[model samples]
Target: MDNLTHSFVGAVLGQAGLKRTTGLAMPALIIGANLPDVDAACFFWLEGTEHLAFRRGITHGPPALVLLPLILAGILWAFDRWQTRRGTRPEARLPVRFGWLYGLAFIGCLSHPALDWLNVYGIRLLEPFSSQWFYGDTLFIIDPWLWALLIGSVGWSWWREKLGGDQRPIARGAIAVMLAYIGVNGAITWLDNATRGTMTEPYPRAYIAAPLPLTFWRREQIAQLEDGRWISSDWKGSDFGYGYANSDQRQCRLPDLTEARRTNSQLDAFLFWSRAPFASRAADGSVILYDARFYDPRARDRFSVALPDVECVELSAG
Candidate 1:
C-alpha cells in the first residue's frame, strides 16, 4: 500500500478513539504506520532493480516491527519531555504514558506489513531471518476505492469530533467495511485460483490474478504453461462461466544466465526479485528481461531492462 493509505489508516485508527490512550498517540500511530518504509532510503545507494530486492524486506519483518515501535516510542517520549522543559506543551494535552505510547506505536507499525502483504508487490515478513517474499494477490498496489473509504471515514470522524460527538462508531464502521471489501476480493482471488486449473485444457503450471486500479471486479491474469509459454488476459468477473480471452501469448523462454547473473550485478538483483521472470532476445542481440506480472507493451521500458551484449538462446517449448 502507498504511504497515504498507511497514514490515513493510522489516522482512522487514532480517530476511532485510540488517540485518548495518551498524549502524542496520534503522531505515534501515523508515523509508526509508515516507519517500515524507512528501507525506501536504499534507493539513494542501491541502483537499478536492487531496490526491489531491498525494500519491503527487513523493515517490515518481525524484528524491525518490534524494534521500530520501541525507537518511535522513545523519540515521542523524548519530544514530550523536551516540550515540557521548554514550557511549550499544550494546555489541554493529556499526560503521556510510555507504555500506552509503545503499544499504540507497535499496533501502527504492525499494520504496515499487514497492509503491504495485501498487495501483489509482496513483502518479506521474516527478513533478516529469511528473504522469502510473500504475496497476497488481494488488492492493487494503489486502490482508489480504499483511499476513498479511508478518507471519507477520517473526514466524517473529524467532523463529528469537532461537534463533541462520539466519532469512534463511524471510524469503526469504515474499518469493518474495508475488511469486508478485502474479504470479498480475497474470495474472488481464491475463486480464480481454484477454477483456473479447470478453465481450459493444459492447465497453467502457475497463475496469478493481478488486481487492476478502479475496476475491482477485474484482474490482469498471468499464467505460465508447463511448456514455458506465458499467457496474459484481462479477466472480468462478470463473465465467470465463459473463460477469458487471452490478450497476448508469448513464448518467454528463460535462458541459462548463471554466468551473466554472476557477472552483471543488475541482472543478479533483477533475477533475485523477479517472480515470473522471462527474457526476450532483441534485434540488437541483447536480452530484454521482464516480469510477467508487470509486463505491458505500452510501458515496456518502465518494467523491463535490456542487457546489452548478453546472448540468451530462445528455448523451444516442450
Candidate 2:
C-alpha cells in the first residue's frame, strides 16, 4: 500500500481513541505505521533492480517489527523529555508513558506489512528467518476507492474533533467499513480462484487475480498454463466470465537462460523478486523479463529488465 494510505490509517486509528493513551500517541502511530518503509532509502545505494529483492524483506520481518517500534518509542520519549527540560511542553499534553508509546508504535508498525501483503507486489514477512514472499492478491497497490473511504472518514472525524464532539465512533465506523470493503475484495479474489478450475478447460497450474484500477470488481487474470505459457485474460465479477485470451501466445516461447540467471546480477535480483515471471527474446538473443502481474505494454519498460547476449532454448508449447 502507498504511504498516504498508511498515514491516514494511523491517523484514523489515533482518532479512534488511541490518541488518549499517552502524549505523542498520534505521532507514534502515524510514524510507526510508515516506519518499516525506512528500507526505501536503499534506493540510494542499491543499483538497478536490487531494490526489488531487498525492500520489504528484513525490515518487514519479525525482529525488525519489534525493534523498529522500540527505537521509535525511545526517540519520541527523548524528545518529550527534551521539551520538558526546555519548558516548552504543552500544558494540555498528557504525560508520556513509555509502555503506551511502545504499544501504539507496535500497532502502527504491524499495519505496514499487513497492508503491504494485500497487493500483488508481495512482501517478505519472514525475511531473515526465511526469504519467502507472501502475497494477498486482494487489492491493487494504489486504490482510489480506498483512499476516498479513508480520507473522507478521517476528515469527518477531524471535523468532529474540532467541534469538541466525540469523534471515536466515526473513526471506528470508518475502520469497520474499510475492513468490510477489504473482505469483499478478498472474497472476490477467493471466488475467482475457487471457480477457476470448474469454468476453464486444461486448468491453469496457478493463477493470480490481479486487481485493476477503477473497476475494483474486475481482475486482470494472469494464469500459467500447464505447458508453461502465461496467458492474460480479464475476469469481471459483474459478468462472471473471462474475456478472450490475449493474442500474444509468444509468451510460451520464452527460452531458458539458467546460465544467464547464474551469471547476471541484475537478472538474479529480478527473478528473486518476480512472482509471475515470463520472458521474451530479441532477435539478437538478448532476453527481456517481465512479471505477469505487472506486464502492462504501455509501461513494460518500467517493469522489465534486459539481459544481453543470452542463449535461447527453443521451448515448444507442446
Candidate 3:
C-alpha cells in the first residue's frame, strides 16, 4: 500500500485513542507505519531493475519487522526528552513512557506488511530467513475508494477533535468499514482465481488477479498457460469468476538462457521478480524480455529489456 494509506491508518489508530497512551504517540504511530519503506532508498544506489529485486525484501521481513519499530521508538523517546530539556515540550504532551512508545510503534509497524500483502505487488514476509514472496490480490496498490474511506474518517475525527468532541467512535467506525471493504475484495480475488484455475487447468504456470485503480469492481487477469503461451483477460468487479478471455494467444518460445540470468544483471533482476515472464524479439533484432503482468504493445519500454545478439522464439495465434 502507499504511504498515505499507512499514515492514515496510523492517524486513525491514534484517533481511536492509541495516541493518548504515551508522549509523541501519534508521531510514533504515523512514522512507524511507513518505516518499512526505508528500503526504498535502495533506488539511489541500485542500478537498472535492481530495485525490483530488493524493494519489498529484507526490510519487510521478520527481523527488520521487530527491529525497525524498536529503533523508531528509541528515536521518538529521545526527541521527547530533548524537547523537555530545551523547555519546548508542549503542556498537552503526555509523560514519556518507553514501554508505551515501543508498544505503539510495534502496532504501527505491524500494519505495514498486512496492508502490503493485500495487493498484487507481493511482499516478502520471511526475508533473510527465506526470500519468499507472498500476495493477497485483495486490493489495488492505490485505491481511490479506500483513500476516501481512510481520509474521510480521519478528517471527521480531526474535525471532532478540534471541536473538543470525542472522535474515538468515528475512527473505529472507519476502520470497520475499511475491513469490510477489504473482505469483499478478498472474496472477489478468490472468485477470480477460481475462474482462472478452470481456464488454465492443464498447465497453470501462473495466474494472478491484479486490481485496477479508481473503481473497486474491475481487475486485469493474466495467466501463463500450458503450452508456453501467456493469455490474458479482465473481470468485472461485480461478477463471480466469469470473465472474457482473449482469442489471441501469445506464445513465448523458451530458448536456453541459463547463461543469461547468470551473466546479465538486468535479466537476472527481472527474472527474480517476474511471476509470469516471457521473451520476445524486438523490431531491431534485440531479444526483449517481458513480464506478462505489465506487458503492453504501446508500453514495451516500461517493463522490457533488449539484449543484443540474442533472438527470442515467438509464435502467433494467427
Top candidate, metric TM-score: 1
The weakest ten consecutive residues by lDDT in model 3 span 238-247
What are the candidates' C-alpha RMSDs? 4.3, 3.9, 4.3
Estimate the TM-score for candidate 2: 0.90
Q: What is the overall TM-score of model 1 with all chains considered together?
A: 0.91
Worst 10 residues of 1 by lDDT: 235-244
lDDT of candidate model 2 versus the reference:
0.82
User: Candidate 2 — worst ten consecutive residues by lDDT sum?
Assistant: 235-244
User: Which of the two, 1 or 3, has more lDDT?
Assistant: 1
* Candidate scoring better on lDDT of 2 and 3: 2
In candidate 2, position 246 carries an lDDT of: 34
lDDT of 1 by residue, 10-121 (tens): 9999988899989999999999999999998998898877787788998999999999999999999999999999999998888999999999999999999999998888
What lDDT, from 0 to 1, does candidate 1 have? Answer: 0.82
lDDT of 3 by residue, 203-280 (tens): 467778888787666667777656566666653321111211322223347567779789888778877887777766
- Candidate 2 lDDT at 248 equals 34
Q: After aligning candidate 3 to the native by TM-score, how far in Å is the CA of 61 from where it should be?
A: 0.5
